[model samples]
Target: MDSHPLKTLLHHHLASDASAVQHVPYTLASLTPAALLPSPHSSKWSARITSLLHAKTSDARWAGLCLAQKSALLSQPVMIESAQSWIAVALPLLAVRSLFLPRLNLMYLRTKRKESPPVLRAAIRLLRVIFTTATEMPEFQRQVATPNVAKFTVALISLVETCLDEELKILLLSTLTRIIPIYPTLHRPHQPALTALCFVYLNGNACKPPNAKLTTAASQLYAVLHLTGGKVGAANLWRKAVDDALDFGWTALSSIRTTFLADGRLPQVQSASEPITSVPLNLDRLRCCIVILGDLFSAPVHRLVQVPLGALVKFALALLTCSKEEKVETHLDPTTRMMESLATPRIWALSCDLITALANRQVFLGEAGPVHLTTLQSFGSHLTPSAPRIATCIAFQLEQELTPSERLPFLDALEALFSRCYTTHATLVVNRLAKTVLPCASSVLSQQEETPVVELESNGRSKKGKRVRDFEGDEVFKIRQVVCPTTVDGQIVLRAFAVLQLLLRNGGLSPALQSIVCRVCLSALLALAQMTPASLSPDVRLHALLSATIQKTCVEFASASVDGLSKSLGLIVSTCLAAGTLQHEIEYLLHPRLPPLLRTMPGIEALSLFRTEESEEESHLIKSFGLASVAPSAPPVVRAGSEPVTLLPKRQPTAPAAQPLAPAVEPPAALIFRPTPPAPKPPLKAPSPALKVGPAPAEAPTLPVPMDVEGDETNEDMPSIDLDSDSDSE
Candidate 1:
């Protein structure tokens, strides 16, 4: 067989030299496909690679790994052909399982030396490339990777456990992440060790100086393992993983709490016999716990797991309290500095995220199921005391220099906290929440207000005129303006209003605080009214919601007997009027619960006139305002030529004079009268001709009829007739 071109190069330059081995990968990468896969020499090249990988020296094995990585990167066909052989040869170099064994004898110790960093790195890189390349081809994976996946996974787990180099560990984690999904069942056996390793790195207990790249890789790998590594359903695995993370975090937190107490960071009740020893705070562990919790909370879980919200709330409150504690240290280590930098903001942000997640999941107040109710009870018990601290933390986070996107979570968290906690601790939550949120919301909204337009006059001389004069003789023009908030700012304002509404609706504010809230709401309403129609569609809804909120604020104030209720209501009415909104739009302001002073206001009266439907409440409102006369009434009847007819009262009847009693007569046996049969009617006479001749005579003068007087004796003397009498013959 012809000699291969790389044989001399590998044996001479790359066999014992590290620098030459570094260039081997580049040299191999630059070679053409024809050169890499020479038909007659392909078998010789494979044999050489296998021999080199199996060589005693680490340098030769390093060179072999480089060549394999390059071969795998070329194409699927080459990877399929060389993957099995490369894996077999490289697995021993990558595995650190033998390092844990005792030194049996001198010969065994000498033969079983751990691989050098370069060789192991090269091996990991080679495997990463192989998996990355093979992931694209089903044939390579099913044919080559299927048979060796179990051992391969075991080797990776060993390296992860025993590998000391952070870079190599990151590489190994990335490699595991890529292949865990493909052979999830194979990884099931090693899932526990893999999980522990991932947590080690994620919790930052592994290395002193925190490596962001390492932590990120471990986190991603951890997620992948739980999502795909288990034989159980993904949902079950996800829930269990979340629960495990929570438990792990709680343990770390307990340790942190103990340290805090020992160090006097937190107040503790100590006994006389107990010795006082200062323990250092494990900021690294705390940071790791926080990062893990943040990731778990931020990710979307498919199942509804009953999270221990009480514990989580306690954890968050502890962190917030710890963050505020003053730590006076003249000197700080790198790890401390790193933890301080990352953990502070992350602490606040994670608190916000946790609250937001709990709210979104509806763990506390979603349904009436047994699980939800239990969670609610536990959460309430924990939150009752810490509600103020939680609100303060949220407010403090909002005051930070956060982007609109970052501010959104804290805002949502604030709103959720207010909504859920306002029931038990309404006064405390409302006062704190309103003080912070209202100002922030107002400032953002005020920034978005349209800037005043500047008007300038041009003094250039007109073409037809000689003297310099004002252009168009002092005709000033103003530009029309619209108040359109950006997408993010608009959302912030909307949420702010929603929170304010919640606070106001809870009816727990002092009169002074209520006034401040009213002013804020009115200012927002004015701003919305000034918005142009061409503004975003969301603004329209915002305008409506703000109007209702203002009305609600007014009603709340009125019911609470707060001062300036009328002023608030009047301001709203005037704002509606100035905004050109129809009077009926704010008819809610005419609530019966409102003070009677609203009735005397012209705006209220005008709005009342526009009410198309008369509810009982409005009727009561009108009556309380003494506005019954102002209400619409029936029209009066009119006459054509004479004056309107006057209504006359009926006259009383006069009593008849007493007359002598009639004498009683003796009864006859047949006193009943019988009517005789009527005679036949006579034939009609022919007198019509004489009556017609006489009809030509002049008619007598018509006499005017006398009008009936109120007490007319002439009509009273007439006898009354009884129609029910049995005198038919007469």
Candidate 2:
């Protein structure tokens, strides 16, 4: 088989060959170490490779860079230790995952002195890439299995434990999550030691700050460990601790966390999705608690059902409500308020997360009928009375926080309430949400007014350095700061838009009301898009969605005036075009991909073939409605939109004449090609043959009896009745 292209590239870079591109194909494919396997001289190779680590010469540094790429792309069991030692020295250099200096650019690539960060990023990225390959690609898993890769796993586990930076910890945890599951016996996670640190990844930091990859990694890890190892090894110990803690019902982690949720049992997961097998290890404590609880539910035939569902929900509610670190509102100053405003909902969100996870677990477990729904019902039963309070909390949090990460759980809780008991609680939640967001909806998109600078007292002493001001106390400044849309802004907009969209779709609001709110949504979105540059993903997406929402609802609420709808549509479309992305409607119009019609018919006339009978009368109906006031088929002098002068048949007070029309003589039989007429159904009143067969041609009138040019002959012809009347009067 031909050598992989990335391998060729790495080899050429190691050889410091500029002409290597000519020798080897320079195509980019997925980078993997499988091709770089089988180092026969593995023992002696590290000594020779270590010289490249100093990277003194340009070619040597190039070789080091190549080696870093190789370490990421090409480590098998034979070279794992050597690669690790090399990685240790070069770990700090792994700063850039996507840097590519072409082999052709030897001078620039070689002469670069700063190499550590790049090497470090390359190393970390390699961990990610390899972990991904091992997890996804079975070939790598089967072919690359080694007896001693556990040593490397242990080192990585240690690194994850000690790593301070969330990014690095994430990288390490992600690597371990993949490694643990495939070779469960290699390490004690599924075998060696499924460390608490690993489980912690699924909590606050992983789930909320929303390091999605990390969270996913951690979740996968836990699930994999649970499924493969089946609560054996260190997994059993962790499970036991959770089982013991929950054996006696505890309301919320708060009641138990201080005493029972110790570091040994408790993980520090800031947020989760990451599992030991799937999620990155988070350092957050609360995240660990929830993740462990989740693991308990995940295990086969556990004690979760024994616990009251109300207890779980109430615990979640209390945790969600009280988790806000800030107590007593700080209305002190703009800076303080703003800082408080943007902070996330914290562990309270995590508590809600646990409830959601529990609910999901019940759903997936499905050992019995309707267990998940029952759990949700229990949750709603408790939430119904506190609906207003929960609704208020949700609304306030949405307003206060900039990041939607922490708000997600609260939103989940609200969704739970809605789904479980929409009648009593859904309206409360939705109304609060709409009321909170609607006021700011327009203002967030509004143009900023310049704030006048306040007069500062002259201190006379020259300031030594540039002073950065956090807040200047002007309404405009505060407004600008508040409205400066970011990912968080996009999230809120999406959420609010989602609520309105749902309401619009589910017939949540009346038609007239729906139209009005839809208009508001469109207007607000337009203002947002206008203020927002299309370069931002959220902004572009919001604009795209705004266009879509309008389209979906416009047809639904047909009572809306066409002129207003047109203006609204024009606003969104023009804004998108202005922003440089084509509007969706315009895209469809310009390239209508309708199914092909039968080609037997010619050109546009084929459309007439499928016309419905009602469609034929559409023009008449249009004319009747006064819409087609000035007919296009009318005289050229007539203007469009003019009131049509319709000639209606005169109405008769009496019923229609029932006299039968004189039957017409049949045409001569010689015209044999003519179509035969069919007998028709009886009519209510038979029309005259003149009406049925159309008026017969009138006979040529006899020329008026010759009238004298200027005499009584004319008078005699004028009418004997008038002359006789005169005679009789005389």
Candidate 3:
């Protein structure tokens, strides 16, 4: 009877070698101990399998060959091969169907997890192939409009997602976001996928669109709204989307506008077939329009300089009234309702950009007065309650006008806005207000100081008791905090210092010094310089800002005489020398401050004194002073045998003079050598005839006097001159 050798079959074919057959079969009934068996082939088999799996493929046949070799019971070869092919086909599908995945996943999980197609492995493999193909195939472009291609693409995405392990889900989502927009599909059913793509496509070009597929997608609006991170995000994204849409084509914009204008209504994302009372404006769309108008206002004045006044007015009005309702009341939190109300969404940033544009060519507004200025006047009032930062931004914008007095109401509104900002937290708004208001603060403070005194009643006669005078309004210098108030966060403090630095560098310091403002300014600088690392670690930027301000203060003080600046400079220098001051703190002092102060103080007397007292040892400091004027080269001595030729004495000491027999006779007063009295300074020559331009003289007899005009004559005692041809001989 023929019987299969199961052991041999298992060892030879499964173990990757014929050598496995040499092992004893069943150990010959186990009576004697079997000779030690050969090493197991498991390790070698594993290595061989790994190599095969990693082997490069020259063609599809390589995959086919790999499939042929893998044992059927041991592996799923077909599944592996299909995974390879799926990568190439799925990439574009994922790109196009990218929007639908999230929603479909939600639906499938809720109602059809078991029924959903088992395409995850196939999907992942296909995605790999597609990415590879994209890099390799130069001519493979996506065909977004074709239904066949779109459907296939969607199927591929669905497959890859189903097979992806949970650990890779986030990574897969990220990849799909980049890949999906490449196919650019607009299927209505694929809204969720498109939304997902938008979340991923932080700055995608498709974001600008009149494309029906994108417009029809239910989640598009939300995706756009949520695209940016928060309040600022909404403002930024809204601006970006409208700008992108405008760039895509004016016709697309016109279509959107025309649809809204028809029947004088805003178009709702919801279907026309659905019952409708009023199509409430989509906050997303409203925000987008606001951003577009904002862009118009904020862009360079020249860009809109030529825009017809009538058109500008019309667009402005349209933007102001675009919303379906008169105002936007978003309940952002349980306690606070943010009302995005506007005569238009006009605010400081908008005012600055727009008014600057109009004022660039004020004549246009002049011609279009009441109608034009009316809108601007309205805008200013509307923005009156805006943030201090916003108010400042707007004020700077209008400041370019030849006379801000023309816009007094607007200025008043700005004052009110800043006043409110100040009341919230004194320091909070000071730094912000300082940017614009500081420029004019001296005048403002002067006016304030005078007003309080005017309210005081003066008694001509002396009273028994002291009289009370109202200097109430003159106290702008006093920050409410006396003792160190709760310290501000580092960033805020840095910003405050930055603003102060700007004020000092720009034109404000002179005025500040001349007015009572100097005290507050000094206090601010001291606060900055004295700030400790424990309180607010000096970052490089904050340090630089403080250094610059200190230098400016030093420069201002430099203009004063030593006595005039003594107290102020002392305060400043001491403040800088306070505990946390670094070496950089003294750097500014040397450049312009200390040098000028030293010059003014009778030859560096003050700094010399300061240096002397501060040295590590008192005796050493005294020694330094005694040695200060000593030359680097040692003192000269007369050497023997060379006509009293001077030589620098060597550092070695001479034997102590033999103890003087009588108390050491004081050293004989050496012949004091004084520089020969400057050769009796040649008598000032009387004005020469040529220099005096005397009357022309009769020609004198011409004869050579043998004078040494070239300075060639030598005195009898002088060494004879040598005129060797070689320059070295001289």
Candidate 4:
């Protein structure tokens, strides 16, 4: 920490003399080329530099400038030090830099005006020289090791964090990127710094027209460390970074609005601090988000789960929304919203990846808890609005036919998206799936079926009978047409089937909802099933595998049902065959596909789908199809004090009232009212009304009364008696 005599002397003399400052460069220039870094004077020069490098000095505050200048001057352009001379100075300089370089920019930035700080600029150059002289050259490369790398990475990371000059940050990061790979094993000591550094660069901006050197540095450094021994640490760091970025994305994008400049460009409006940068910082942020996710996704399943995927899903949407092109009063199309960042095909691709990643990350796939609910709402907002475009991008990319490794992740993502998203989001996904399958479906639907027919005629060959008509038959064969889907199309459709199945199971659908979804899924399912390969091809094999996977999921991972899915598959064939693309299915096929469950009750039709009786439109779609009929309107409401109501059927006037056969036994039942029956003189000829299912109500009992088990009212009690002495005559 103490100042060296030479350093103190140089500082003091340079202020007063001014001649000493001029004398040094001249003195160095006047020296013999070998003496400057001359072979003859190499040993003595190396010795002096070694002493100067080791000397305690007041250089701590100005280390970046002093060391950078010294490093530049020592590694002269006119005469290179023999590889031998590098031995003494190279190790010490590297050692000193690691110790001193971490905060090179902070002090420099404070004193700097608009221009880049001299110290940091010199320092970046110094690092480049050290890296080239040491790691890049084969002769001195042995000096690169973990301890040195740790120091270098830490220093560079600190500079990157504090350096205001984007140029310097880029320089520092790029240098570290090269050095870190030389000794990837040593970065643990500098993990935190590396993580922060990666975050900055992965989301950093460009210098001119736009580039991603920092992003590349970030990517390289991460790859060297993480892909080797630091998988666990890397995954943790990535997860944390993703969560943080996702939070920032949510906050940043939720508030990010768009407006049109006078020139017709959609300018992004964010908080005052988030100044717009030409490098597309939003794109960088999205790139960072996707990189972390893309890497994590490639990690083991357990490691992948470490990510808070729900946030990633929201973050992806947030990225798109934030980057969306805002068309104002201009001739440009309003729908063309892919910005510089999003317009790059990768952004759209990443968006789908994150969506798919989110889908794959089902801790509780169908859980209806608070977290799931939030995820559902967020996913709906992000996906429903842009699913068509996202799908288009994905389809286009797939059309490029990337390598299996490259393409499978996308397919996995699509499968995950279809399996995981639900409700309206699920509807959007189903629509995408339908679009994916429609081409194949249309091709298959055009094929025709042939049936074999046979005719039997009486053959006149009299082998054994009188009128032996032998069977003369024209044999025909029946060709049951199969859907004939392509291998890729079949696999994609099969996956689509899984998605539909997941929607029903994951949504915890009610019978009505399940029925509605079944119908919707069934329409697409039928279209897809039409291409269902009868023979076992790759697509057919995948179908069988998918069926088993789904069955297994139902058995273990999820509470879904293979049988239910099979049933859905069957219904898809039947209903779709019956009502080709059920009216409501088309609702989901359009841009911004909305789930039928969102605005309407589960019903037979969507377009002609009628609201309940609450509406005054007086519509009846169910009745129109003759599937059901309308009932007569209800009678008007009766007042509380209105006349007594009766529910009894009207009596026939042609028949006289019947007398009870047990009239003699019933006369003693009510002695107090016996006088009413005394004057009856005519004999009753009519029979009683036929006994109904329940006991007939007594004629004398009031209609509103509650039935008592002990009422003891007999059939003979209230009978119309025969008054012509018919009982006595009998």
Candidate 5:
């Protein structure tokens, strides 16, 4: 040029009067640093000028002004000192990546060698603001502002991507991530710069971009999917990325997978439509995606966006069928192929999680609803042997999310599937059956008595806690206990014992004539709390059920003869009594109805007999059957006129008396049973004449008048008949 424009501008500005500089505003038009390759003529003068610019200044304004003075101000300490002013002027102009800016950045990098990466990272961050504004500029303003800033950003990102230093690349990509949205146009454009950037970003070699960046990139790809008529521009991106990752040619896929699983927000990318990089939809990617989505759904309803649920399900479905080759065929071998055909842990976990999330919202469909039924029915038709288990696991998860009212229905649907899986199949281990139904029992129990308590605040106001006593939410003051039967191979196992004891002792189950249930219950109780753990997890519901189950079992068959009901009951009673938790249930069994049930139980009753010594017999029977007794020391037989005992009492044998008494046999068989009320005719005749005395008019005590058993000694020997049972129905 006539003279380098920056040099000419600087000379003109400097030659002007210092005071006049205040009013005269000068713009640097086409100002740029002189070439590092110097001309022979002005070399010494240029060197002097550079030295002066580098000199220290006492005045800040002077340094600021000098920074604004010319673009030739590189290499000056003043330029570094006047960062704020330099940024103001240079940011707009230097937004573009070119020879000049690269050299300037190199100089800045060299000068700030001692700064930490973070600090240097901060310095480059200013470029984001500049580029952001540059993209928004009007066409004419962009010309005046900065040229090719968008392309420059792409180039800058490319340079970072090519770098070997991982940390630097991460920093650079992070910056690019923020700046890229400045040109939303490139997000879909297949122009050279746009295409190059897509490859560089997708290649992800520089540093594993953060989850946020990957999310953004994913969103952009989705945008492209929507905007570009399903452009094949990105067709190659997904294949290349996934294939390269498989070969370890690129590690970004692994990093992205980690982020996809860990980040609950990735499902938000659903709005990003028509994603080109189906890398995220590949089997491994989908596995992580499902987990993350599930986690989000598992969170409180407020934490999840409602629409994402359907979209995610759709996305997962697409991925499952998208490949040209069957997914099973991709595995290394037959076994691997079989496992793939079945759900992997990650896949199973994903399915469970997704189903759980869907169920959490009462939005059961797909694997959580009717489709799940088909999945169950078809059990391994097209799937591997393990598929049945996977289906069960998924159903179990969905079942777990149903409200108490919904659980039975959910289970019913699942049970059909379970039945189809095989004659014997369970998502839960046998021991873990408690986990399944206890929650249902707990839900019922919670509803039975949710007495609200007021919680006072500092302001003297109060609030009621959630009605359900979920430990995850709030502490519950009361816990209701219930018992359920455990089944094994169509037979009641240890759980049946608990159930029988509960029915007999608590009177809780319906279908009152369930005689088979009783046998089932007794058999399980016979397991004697063996399968019951010594300690239980704090799954409040499960623990309560187990505790109640154990308590019922103990009280029911404690007197088993094999263990001898007394020994068994004693072990249970002592265990419970010593523990102090079973005292209440023990008291409940003392209800009038309980003892006979215990005494009549053949196995249980015989065991009670074993606990008693002849000397201790009557009292021992009273204690074991919990029968009320006249006295602790009362003999089993009462003496009246004292006849030696003919046989044991109908209930249980009693203790013998110390003395033998003479046989007081009735005078005659007829006399032994008194039936003679002379004749009712005497009552009328007596009332007519002799019976005019006092209450004699009561008519000879009324024929068929119930024998005054309380007053009659002979009647005393008669067992107390249950009068209520004798009452004829009207």
Candidate 6:
């Protein structure tokens, strides 16, 4: 007795009097499967939708297509029940009538006139929904989709061939790609047609001008066809595509080379015998070929095949080498000259893309051994001349706000370039490495101190029987910061540091250049150590690494130039002392490496004194003095022989020539300081009772044992005093 809800909503929304259909989608979306197809009215709902789809008017068909798509999305059961009727009517809407007049030899195909855009778009969406819904349920696919695969394939291909609208064609291609994977064999019969259609747009020889969006979609479809079409001949298919593209690209490149030289000058002598049917240089065609190569290389299947790295590298090099010498003249043909002017840069960009694809693939496969080394060698050879230009580009990109995905690859590329080429181009590479590393490291160090404020509610009552106050607090209420460099900032900083270390170890810069580099490295590392979070677990390890690097740098510089080493050591000690951080780091550096150097060098004694004093202070603080307290001892000063010299407590003037004096007690071994081993002192004879009633020879004033100005290792094995002890005994 009641009109169907589907019909009622459709009539209300699609009425001829309705001025705007803007609200129709939302109004229709509100209808649920239960409301449209109640148990009692399910059959009637299907009947109503079928009748509407078969209606003559465009509005009726649009409403029906919209309902079909929504229904397919809402309830898979409803789709299964009425899919036949939906497909039956939707396929007819794509057909265009062609009228032929034999006498005049004219044919008229009315695509737009027959099917309006609204109806066509809706039909495509509805079909996509149907295929997608079928894919989710195996039962539905087996019973409903498997039987109709051929029919659907034929209809979609027919529309693709005759469709005049670009948007519609793209939609058709996308849908075909989606459905092909559902039942790859079902679409096998029509694979050739689909492949050809995709290539039409891919090759940029379509009936209309090339559309980037369309070409991208076509490339995606092409890859899917080969990837999922069948695995039997997939590799061969990829190989053939790559080979054909390379052949065509090389031909086009040769033609361009003949026209323009590397420096943009015309060649003095041209080849006498030109190839028959020389392909003219088409920039679009060239770009398409490069894009294809990029896509093929980027695919996961690339790992299974042997990529032509040599050919790819050579091609990229040739493209990068070809540069325009001067601007185009006004008298030349506008199209030809514009292509020539724009061609080089665009080709260069595409070539770079190809190179990136290869690099990323190599990295992804984890082939970083001999194979990767060979690849890097190839890139380095080609990239040596353009190192500055490439470095500039890399630096400029790094300065931008890039996501981790983008930043990481550029970093990897930069590292690869520097590692292979720094031997010959140390200055250029080292300078760029510094420029890239310092800023990123500084940024990470800055973030370590940023403790954001957080607020918390207290559960316990105050002592006054009032609710605890609410306030913002720093660090106490904030979550504990991560210890490792897990964040993006930390990752960038870590990567930059790695690159810096790599260059420092292998770059082999001259003394002057190395000093500059060592200075930069020390500054960055000190900042990292000083600002490193207290709670971070890597603190000890980071400090150790920093010390090791500094030690190695110092040793290297000392071997080459002592003055530079002194300056670097001075900078390091001064920075550590000033910041009051990296105390352990400085100790590690100074303990073994510092004593071997000349102590007369400025700041060397001060550094030694500072270390000794700090150690004494720490010992005093840690060691407890019992009730029988003792005076704090002075720090033992480090002398030239890498051993500390301490002055023993002066004894009271004994018994002024008194009659009997107790036997003199010898000083403890640790308290004794022997300069030059005391020349194997003669064994002393026992003193006779008659010996010495007069005053004992006044003990020669112990010269403050002359400090070892040149730290010598000969006395390194001598027994040294323990300044940390308070006891006078050994």
lDDT of each prediction vs. the true structure?
Answer: 0.54, 0.42, 0.33, 0.41, 0.34, 0.53
lDDT of 4 by residue, 1-730 (tens): 9644344434443222233334445433433433334344344444444344333431321232343345445555421343333323332332222333444422222321122354345445554555545444554455433234344454466556555766666676667656654455565556566766666556544343334555655655554444233545544554554466566554433322333342345444543433344225554555555555554444322232243444554456543333233345645423323244234344545566677655443332223332221112223322334444444455555555344333444555555654444344334444344334333223322343332222212232222434222255523443344443346544544454454454444433333333333333333334334344463234556534543433322222111233333333344334434434444332322222343344222232221222332122223222222222122222222121222322232222322345544343232234322224452444324334432123234743221112211122233234444454567767
Q: Considering every candidate listed, which one attains the maximal TM-score?
A: 6
Ranking by TM-score: 6, 2, 1, 4, 3, 5
Error of 1 at 245 (Å): 2.5
Q: By TM-score, how accurate is candidate 5? A: 0.28
For model 5, give the 10-residue run with minimal summed lDDT. 701-710
Worst 10 residues of 3 by lDDT: 444-453
Q: Report the lDDT tens digits of candidate 2 across residue range 1-730.
A: 9855444554553354343223222322333555445554344334545666664544454444454455455564534445445544443343221233241121221223444433434445544444444445465544443422443554455445544566666666666655654555545433325545544554444234455556555654554454234333434443444554343223224322221223334323232222331122222444555655665555343122333345555555555554233333323334322332322245566666665565455322235632332222243433445555556666766666444556545556554544443344355455446544443333343444443332212221114433223366544635334342566555544455544544443323333333334445544545545454453233556655654544443323322233433444555456556545545555543443442231111122211211131253433432332333221232212111322221212222232333324333233342122232422433223233222122233542111122111231122211112222466567
List RMSD in Å for every model shown: 27.2, 22.5, 28.9, 27.4, 25.9, 20.6
- Pairs that collide, model 6: 640-708
lDDT of 6 at 319: 63
Candidate 1: 10-residue stretch with minimal lDDT: 271-280
Residue pairs with clashing backbones, model 1: none
Task: Please write out the lDDT profile of model 6 over residues 1-730, one tens digit for every residue.
Answer: 9866656655565443231134457656677866655566567556656766877677877877887787788877788888877876776676555432232121221233578878988987887777777577788788767876666666666667677888988888888777776667777777787778877776644234557877777776676565544666666666676687788677656654444544555434343432222222255667677777766654434234445556666676666555544453324334443455555555555655655555444312235422221122233443455545555566655555656544665565566655544344546655555555555443433334342222212222333555433366743876655444444444555566556555555433333323334444554555555544443334445444543444444334333334444555666566556545557645555554545343212222222112123344333322321201122323233222232333333332221222322233233342222322222344323344322212234542321122222232243334433344779765
lDDT of 2: 0.42
TM-score per candidate, chains pooled: 0.43, 0.44, 0.29, 0.32, 0.28, 0.48
Query: Which ranges in model 1 have alpha carbons more than 4 Å from their true place?
Result: 1-57, 97-113, 131-143, 198-212, 216-221, 224-234, 254-282, 294-393, 396-730
Candidate 1 or 2, higher lDDT?
1
Error of 3 at 55 (Å): 19
Cα-lDDT of candidate 5: 0.34
Winner by TM-score between candidate 6 and candidate 3 = 6
- lDDT at residue 640 of model 3 (Cα atoms): 26
